[model samples]
Target: MTTYSRRAPRTLLLALSAAAVASTLSAVPAATAATAVPTLTWEPCASTGGPTDQECAELPVPLDYRYPGGRQLTLAVSRLRSDRPEARRGTLLVIAGGPGSSGVQRLTQKAAALRKEMKGAYDIVSLDPRGVGGSTTASCGLDEGDRDLVTLRSWPAPDGGIADNLARSRRVADACARNGGAVLRSFTTANEVRDIDRFRQALGEEKLSAWGISYGTYVGAVYAQKFPRHTDRWVLDSSGDPDPSRVARGWLANMSAGADSRFPDFAAWAADPAREDAGLRLARRPEDVRAVVLGLAAELDRRPKASDRPGRPLTGNRLRQALQGALYSDSAFPQVARLIQQAQDPAATPVLTPDIAGALSDQVAAVTMGVVCNDVRWPAAPASSYARAVAADRVRYPLTAGMPVNVTPCAFWKGAPVEKPTRITGRGPSNILMVQSLRDPSTPYFGALRMREALGDRARLVTVEHGGHGVYLGNGNACGDREVTRFLTTGVRPGRDTYCAD
Candidate 1:
């Protein structure tokens, strides 16, 4: 659910920068000891797309922060310098979404739009976290079949059985432990915070302003907490609950309600008479779309249908997964509606979404699993505990069908967390701004409220009366983008929490 893609409205499918100079390391906790800053030599980016002015560099960070002088790994970094140097105040770091998302790539994709928005207020920069694109990498060496999105996401069997999930979870855990060495184990949120600080030092900047999205918001929050003095205007967009006790676990569990909250938007869109022209409408009334989808999924459970893909069939769980992905944005409604129409017809072959059609790259699977499993410890409860939770969740939230609470590699992950998850509190500078959609399928508004509560007076919330994943520059609501841009450019925030009407 924390995946990052440039698809419109920022799709939530599990898919799986820089500079340099020198600055003194600020005195902080010894646990995050200062390390030698590497000089960043920038060159034209290798990619031909994106802003032509974008430049690339690499920064060397310690593989393990406890021993900063020990083994080193390369972090790919990129930057788009402010065109109007006189207007530039400082660097703005773009923290990407996924534990596996490439920050360098994100900067590339959004550089043009961001440049226009900032109007030369800051030099925008981003970086690839360890095990991400163009950075030092590791692999769990998982089998091809196990890397499929549906399989990796822990979808229960057709009969609501988790026996297969348990086996797969253990298998993935074992494979990661066996093949992923210290490099993979080092991919925790704590380490990423350290790496970001190190990058700040390399940039010769005393402080960093950031726009952190989705999982990046977690990283940004942790960074702000761990190194409060080094933060400038911070923006957390599409954030999850910052409960240290239940970091990734709580985020995943909350998706059930998130899906339910966001589904009505898609339902209304699908039931619109406008969709009839494209042969994509599912029901005559908005209320009937849910039953139509549920009935089709239930029918698929009874008898799988042949899909456009040869070996892969359109099964019940796959349809459900597609629905979950499509719920993230209105742009995806037509594809899902068409697939539903195809499945209802016996002669037609349903086309699988790209996420369900193939396996993720081994590196992506490794990073996604590594960060979540290593960030915090999952409960070591008996399988029956999970079974009961899943059963209850299914009836309570049929859209997710218990997938949110199902067993994952984290349940069987080996080794304890190197450090406890960072508890985000209101102890830091009151410079944080959070923007969240009311009905975000991945990180729901309710979860964002929990983060807001934890941050207390240190942060103010901008609740958008919209439905989708990303908010600013995402749903294209003028009100939401205005508030965020105002804060970023003028260093002025709303007097209190505010709402932006859709």
Candidate 2:
């Protein structure tokens, strides 16, 4: 199953006319011809969601560019003005990772970290994409049963069959089509990039520096390509493959390799005597830790165990999904180990994290699923094709099993993409900086390499010798964070690609 860090499927290549897409979307449409830029009425945020310094505002933009002034939607925006006004160069936009991450929430969570790194060189700002928190939203009216992470993720059945996943995909897709209406459909990456340009104009800023994480990285890359002159300093943190043909599909598949790559760190940690005090050690040897986990999961497959959550039992796929999610960071190792410990005890009740215990509300799930499905078209792959993929993935990658390759809501999604997914190239100015971990479970380093390659000399990759997704100001990678901080402040990047050791 995918982590909070999101993914998409397939690698169907399409060579979009970048010149055409760029020329068309670089600014507000001609339909709003000579429409004076709307001024912001910044006020104290109603919620204490962010820091005391954080202020909030609302921005209105066209619901659809084709009819620029016909109907409008408001984006919730936040700002942490530079503490050092004299040092302030410009505004820095923070792009949160999820197809569903609320930018306002991300800004609040990272305010302190960003405060220190930025040193008041730029005002930090973020906004909720439409259909997200504090912004206008839409719902699929999905049943609660279909909202669980395991169920929503398209995990195959206990017997390595995809029939259940296929059924769920069709059900979820149909529900969205029937209930999501227009707001949900608005949740595409292209739309978000367009929204950003509007935000820049509203701020009255000539150019913007940015830090785009996870899926936001794609948005930033597109924005840079579409409006090269408008980018002052751009940072793509924990980027996924920008393979136009596959987009999200490629990201989902890359995660399988990421899991394989990062699990060793967890296994070694679990086997260490250091974990004994925490009652977390699963085995005395690294390899045995893997064996124990695999064996336990396989055992659970045959007979599910009751968990602390009523009516929701711990199953094989749940355990695998937990493992995949936990492997995102070493800090989660204890929780998963504790889960294994509880599962091993016949009389003990297994504990579940909020993510595993509570399902996302229908509106939340819709927004998350919306961007992935709307960004690109999926193939009409038959069940037999998924079965083969599931069977093969289960045998080859036990850590992720076949979940990463299995069918999802996108396969049964209703609408064709509004536009062809943008094809990233070496066409932008050399103003991009990408920082990535060596082993990111959601967006792997190898995938980041493809993003780096797509940018050609337009970008530089700071390979952090660590494991986890979203590297800069994340994972405590001092080297990587320092490089990014330096670039944002001075506009100087590595002359050639480089690496940062743990």
Candidate 3:
């Protein structure tokens, strides 16, 4: 579920020595060298289609680095081998976005595109981060209402109150503490990085080149920082701020600017005459589209519309939630605009997408909450501060309604981070290339600039002047895609920051 915003597994600790791993490493061979390949056992696993090529394998890793022979958890792994073995350069790991997102499914969805682009240049691989889809799981067993996206995201009240948010955050935090097990306790970025190294060892790659997107960019950056020598060619797409101190908290907060940056694109699309016949045109002018949306949201706040569904009328929060969803992609903008048009017209009926304001699985919410909670501490006064922020944000960027800076369970998250969050310094190998959209609704240009500054001489940034979450292969921009493709294939990056005009 890619919301306008923003998984915890076991805290498996591994102290990876770059030289030692490179010398005769257990997981991967040294960079620029080939070694004996370790055997990988592939077996069927879980997905929408019952018996796909999905496979499961275990990577034995120390539970605690201090106690090397301690207990271990089997990390579920999946792979899609390249079609052309002769052209295969190496294994390119697809690091999933959410700390809670499934890497296996991502591999399946993007395999064709990756294979087509690279042309048997690499075997695509991914793993379910602990406590995520198909991985070893944990549960908070939250009630249905608490798991709803509107409630879970801690959106301010229609009337601008946050009392419900305060109560919900505390209640959800308590539920997780009581019901979530040790596996839930282990969900942290440091542990995920450790598990990745162990998986690298299990795969028998000397150095792992990776394509990390969204939240995965942070994970990739940490991996690069922790094990600089283990990297081959790293690609971070639609990246967020890499301020390790705030981690996921900062990423969540960044949605404010992200949505602001992206909404104009949607506005222009909704205002286009091309959308008139589609019944998706919200207004005649681009600015009018924004006004109509905000006005409708405000009107819904005052008097919610009765929908085809029984009690689920289009409410203010519902409209806001829809806006959040629409900002993700161009394809979705029309649907959201249609939702608005239907709500405005009494005779018309709007088809509500189940995802707009539904309850995510208790498990999904838990993992989403756990990772942010466990990674870093947020101020407990989020509700109070958020109310103020939302009011200010509504004035500053009315498109998002200040939900981006609002509160969440992290404010009341029970667990403390096990290890220090990795600050992505420029001290690593200079082999990293970042491809970012200038107007990404989720990871805005401001945050990406922070990452660019942090990476210093280690990275070359290719800025795609587009409007979307992902730049490469997402927005219809040849310049951005070519820059990334060239870098991934030939190991050549732009001499400096380059712009790709849409």
Residue pairs clashing, model 3: 7-99, 7-100, 8-187, 9-186, 9-187, 10-186, 11-186, 27-201, 29-206, 89-121
Q: For residues 1-58, what per-residue lDDT tens digits would candidate 2 score against the true structure?
A: 1111011111110111122223555464644433335567888873555578789999
Residue 108 accuracy (lDDT) in model 1: 89
Better model by TM-score: candidate 2 vs candidate 3 = 2
Lowest summed lDDT window (length 10), candidate 2: 1-10
Q: Candidates' TM-scores?
A: 0.93, 0.93, 0.89
The segments of candidate 1 whose C-alpha lies over 4 angstroms from its true place after superposition are 1-34, 46-48
Model 1 scores what on Cα lDDT?
0.87
Q: What is the C-alpha lDDT of each candidate?
A: 0.87, 0.84, 0.76
Q: For candidate 1, lDDT tens digit of each residue in 159-228?
A: 7899999999999999999999999999999888878877776676667899999999999998988878
The per-residue C-alpha lDDT of model 2 at residue 482 equals: 92
Q: Point out where model 2 deviates above 4 Å.
A: 1-22, 25-34, 46-49
Answer with 2 or 3, whichever has the higher lDDT: 2
